[model samples]
Target: MVKRRDVRNRLLRLFVGVLLIAACSAQAAEMGGKSDARILIDISGSMKQNDPQNLRRPALRMLVGLLPEDARAGVWTFGQYVNMLIPLGQVDAAWKNKARAEAGNIASPGQFTNIEDVIKRSIADWEGSATLYQRHLILLTDGMVDISKNTKKNAASRQYILEQLLPKLQSHDAQVHTIALSERADHELMRTLSRETGGWYEQVNDAEHLQRVFLRIFEKVGRPDTVPLKDNKFLVDSSIQEVTLLVFRKESAEPTQVITPSGTQFDAKSAPQNVSWHRDIGYDLLTISHPETGEWRIQAAMDPDNRVIVVTDLKMRSSQLPSRFVLGEVLPVTVSFTNQGKQITRKDFLDVVNLKSCHTDSNGTGEARPIFDDGQDGDKAAGDGEFTLQVGQGLAAGKVELVILAQGKTFQREQRQLFELADPIPMQVTSTDEGETKVRVQPDAELVDLESLEIKAALVSQAGEEQPVMLLPSAEAGVLETSIATQELLGDWTLSISATGQTRSGTELDLTLDPVRVRGTATPPADPPEEVVEKTPEVQEPAVEPATMQAPLADEPATEEDNSTFQVALFGGINLLLIILVVLAIWIMRRRKQEPEFQLVEEDDQLVEEATAK
Candidate 1:
């Protein structure tokens, strides 16, 4: 009996354990795939004109459809302000209907693009809510921050987004994927935000491509493991280190064929000795070490959804150039390329490398091709991938992105380096009481090639009047000075200096000074012309003889007029006293009336009597 009981208990325990495991697996399967996403839509005024078709509405609706029912999402629109149209909530029929309606109603255009505020709000929302879903932010913008109007504020906004908000998003494990809707968008900033947060940046030039980009984002979020590899062809260049093909299918095993550059076919079932492959339940990973340089095609019989990834063996390295540069200065850049730990020394391969400098500013973009340095112009050696870039008169003061594109027989690679060019010469204006206005130009000795320095100055007034001023080179090494006459220092004048050398640089200074006063010549009062003292004759007043007047004594004051005056004075005094007494009496009566009547009554006469009796 004891043995039987023990067997029954063991069986029951095993059955219960099985049921618990199944329940947990089902729960995990239900919860694991759900995602949390926030969609940021740019509704700035520029978007209305730039995106004429209003493709964002449809794209947003499609995104809503793509989200699974278990997912949670929210929508926000930003301009000068940010508005949350749909708070983060579970995606259901009701939620979808409301989200779509609100998204469709976002037709009104806004004034400015306040991207930083929306990003902050999104981060706050995500941090405030605790969930197990993977977090994502889909930021789409048609215009950059409105820096033209308030540059300082806009710059601060950008800084806050990068410095303060980006880290918070990172700590929260939220990825920010950015979509640039038009050419005017700040693509560099958008790319930085996405790349730093392990997300992708997509640029959609036309409204028609909006849907496709949105779909791609959806795929990335929903089915991240699925690689779209159908009908994909990859060029395997000599620089490539390894080529990997991932085939994802529903079948247990599928035949995958890879055609090499020399028309050699390799099958997954009979892969060559050089090929490394792994087979799993529903996927296959095929890798070729040091793939040959040629066109390679991959095809799977069962799974059309596959992906080919190419890893280059080429090791490219570049250093961060000085963030600041003086205008008219030469920028020397060195790039090195290596393959499989060996430096590529082929002359033809080095010749195919091209460096493109793209300088962008508020005005526009300027591009230039830099030449390879061969032991000339500050370059120490040649053919080692050292190039010197000269920013000359044509390029304005702005940020520059240096792009290096190197192409081999079958592959091409690109790398970008960024730097900024600043005006080399510093300018200032000074004025003196002597009616002389002086303009000074100081060049950066380190960056300015003084041998080729040429400086020009002009005084521009507020009324758009410009007067050319001659620059007088100072005895100092890198100083240029110019003076303007007091007469020309009219209403606010700006001293504009244009310096040209290996590069061209210019700066403008407003010349505001106190009015110059001209001293008037004072002739001595001519010695007052020996001022003649004119004496005026004074008329003497005739002396008049004083007459004696009789005065009344104190005893003679009993006259009738005096008596009458005294009586009148006495009567007025009496009346004044009487009026004072009357006013005092009235005041006393009013005060008494305001006071409450004090009635001394016996308090609880019965109790007092009882106590007394006790």
Candidate 2:
């Protein structure tokens, strides 16, 4: 009888441990919960030019250190092949230490970019559809798929990644956030990955910006609860057990220091027993345990990237927002407060709370916009403990952050979401057989009223000469077209484009487009580069980007075609991810199980290796 009792106790303990592990991993997720992230970085020879100083090292370190204890993550670097740079495991002090130490080995020596392999190996153990963990894959690359020098084989592999690999990841509800580190990087491919998988995509022309980008990705993945920093100070409520200050420092600035609620000042050198300080290349990450419940001040230079995150019982719950979007997209965001695990929904107690959308655009300027619980604007229903607002009006395309700040009579809580806004228009430049350059524009019929659209186009010569063009409706119903006399033009000519349009709802639009350049054919034309006075935007092509892939938001319900594909993020909201509907998600899970499973390539020493060997 004694032996049997002991056996029963041991089994119970084992079952409890299994449950704890399951709880630690997920996808319920209200926005910004525990994280399960897989990181894929490129280390091909091209990095020698793109990241000569290896800023990826410090950037990776910052991400690893900021990961809370509940997160599960791993890092893989790919080039000639894929290598698990750091093994996937639950995040803890030991995991962080190992990850940070291994980061020093990040170097650009690989021969090719085997993006396909790295992605496969990273998520080999991930299975099932519905779960508790929000799955995210961060892919950083500066080039296209190049598994081999054979151009056809490389193209096939890239195709496989899109056709075969993407569906499998989508089936598992994984979001792939991508970073293109150089202008030469495959922006189209990265954009497709982000768009199809509900991941965020960013293009960083310079490697120096990797750390900042990584920080934003961390905000999306980790979703750390935070206290708003006002004028270099933040207030910690009684519910906050720990607070972390991530302060960016200027090269000539004094070391960052903080003053606690007790009026005690502490710097990295003189931090108290409960404080942990990690000062990195351009910023400082400091955490304090059992923080006093009061306002805290930072004695350092003020920067927008600076933040104060907390481990707290009181949380400002928010609607999940996608981290990537285009201009002309209006995003609805909602927020509420929770104490411990239950929501604080008393109208009398909540009526006095001030909820705001604090914005920082590409220019690094700050703006505060009010959100209300009055059941108007984009708010579905109001005053039921939910406050709502819609943003993306009069906002430029670039890196942005929307800080959801809620301040009540006694407590202050904030959540930060970072996103990249893509240009609404995609310009395509191609030379006609006649040596003329054609520019096409086919706006999304669903988003824009075709009749009210006006597109302006100009051909800019390398020598700074511009020739304006006129646009007219094409034969097709919703297409616009124009042709530029580029036959006589000598060097590369850049197409400068700007537009004015009105949505079907009659809202005026001002749009910006990137410069699209095509080389001259070397054949002399009837008109000289400077002499050609006129050109117009045209609709020689139906879609610069696939029309079918245009992301459909919740406000705009999808047709059967859209619903057929597993679309919509499970948790994403403001600029967030993950908002999977219960019944619909289960349906998707059933449908996904019927599709053929993707098989990873068999392991080979030359094709795969551990980073430890390097």
Candidate 3:
């Protein structure tokens, strides 16, 4: 009986686990496999100057409103520390309401900008590779990675993000989209993070357009199905169950007049019963449920940013291009369409459609390119829904927007990707020994014309004075050298670099690099070498010594020498006296021996006489 009960409990547990897995899988399938976003906002002190009006509050609210209901999201504000302003959870009415309420609390009251720490903390829960959801990290900042006053530590923080933190993000398939809010922001690092992670990057000079920027990023993250709008008119297919119209206003009234397929007209205030309209500072978002499958039009002051997104069975899909690229890198771009959440791979349908691509340079001049499904142009197979194009060859180095247009005799779809082409020969500045500032340009020899790379630089003082410094060819090839004069290298200076070069393919390259901040106290000038004076040698005459106090002999320090000489003389005299005494003793001994007998005989006679007298 006990064994049967245990088996029964085990079976019931297994059943419950299977059902839970199925429910989770169903939730992922509903969101089209990936829709999780992590938003990181900078609350550093610098934002006070950059975003004084605190326009980010409204911008963030707009983003929170636009996020799909099924997606999971969280918000974090980072400065010297990171705070989870909103916990990560599935987006619902409650979550959106909470986010909206907290958006007002966004302020620039925090201390240093610790980008690395915030990013690490934001992704703490993410460990493994992307599977069920496509993760997005949207970072907004107005300053560089400044956790301390030490410049080296700040540089180390930036490097740690690129070298260590970036790989972990990549491993987890987290797209890091960075928005720079000021000119002083670290654009180089911002561009690199987004470029490396295949995410969007934008620089907003004014806070006024922040809402628009957020909307653009939302489109990328949401991957919303959008129908092409031509001259304020769009055709909604039968598969579109819902349509959301985003219209920009010029005068702060109703953004636009939305006319439905059934000739029903609506605006923000006079919207139909089923239509949901939201009016914000600069734009309006109208969500229509079960829209008619026919032509629709909007009457508004024409704006390029006007858009209509749909929730439908038919969706156009494309692999996103990276946010930035090096001059020599070539990447493959692909576009396709899916119906009912599956790729439309029908050759007959694909044959009737045309997919075209063009790239617009910074000057708004677009050059057209060919895209095809034929097995020739980087496409794996012929007649597949996928269309491929190999781009980035001979393109100028700057901001370029890629536009892909697909037209199927009946419907049209379009997508745009913004990317930056970095200089092939990235320049580096280093504070060398002896106050020498060096600009090193080492591009791949095979890719760049080294001799044609011309480098120009200037030393900019704190007072904003420019002193053009010549960049001569350094000892190493492809290196440009310049020295920081002690007088000009006043503490807290900038090195401005302007370079023009050529690719091996004969393409001209013009680049304006970010000014490099060099920190050092001006070195004090070496005191003028002390003047050496030549003087005649003084002739010295010996002074006459007093009789009582004779001056010591000064020749060759003879005090010691004289003492030693006297000692030798005294020793020699004593030895001579000893020798004389010895000789005299010997002679006397011989004489005594010879004369002893005669003296003894006389003394004996005397003694005998004396003895007789006694």
Per-residue accuracy of model 1 over 494-570 as CA lDDT, tens digit each:
66666666532222221212222322223334454566899889898564322221222445555498876785675
Model 1 residue 269 distance off true place after TM-score fit, in angstroms:
47
Model 3 clash number: 1
What C-alpha lDDT does candidate 3 achieve relative to the native structure? Answer: 0.81
Q: Could you give candidate 2's per-residue lDDT for residues 388-430 as a string of tens digits?
A: 8786776767777788888888888788877766665555566
Cα error of candidate 1 at position 445, Å:
30
Off by over 4 Å in 1: 1-32, 128-131, 224-614
- Of candidates 3 and 1, the better by TM-score: 3
Would you estimate the TM-scores of all the predictions? 0.35, 0.67, 0.63
| Residue runs of model 2 more than 4 Å from their true location after superposition | 1-32, 362-367, 397-400, 420-441, 445-472, 475-478, 481-614
Q: Per-residue lDDT tens digits of candidate 3, residues 560-581?
A: 8788688567656666766777
- How many clashing residue pairs are found in candidate 1? 3
Candidate that beats the other on TM-score, 2 or 3, i.e. the better one: 2
Show the colliding residue pairs in model 1.
229-306, 241-313, 328-503
TM-score of 3: 0.63
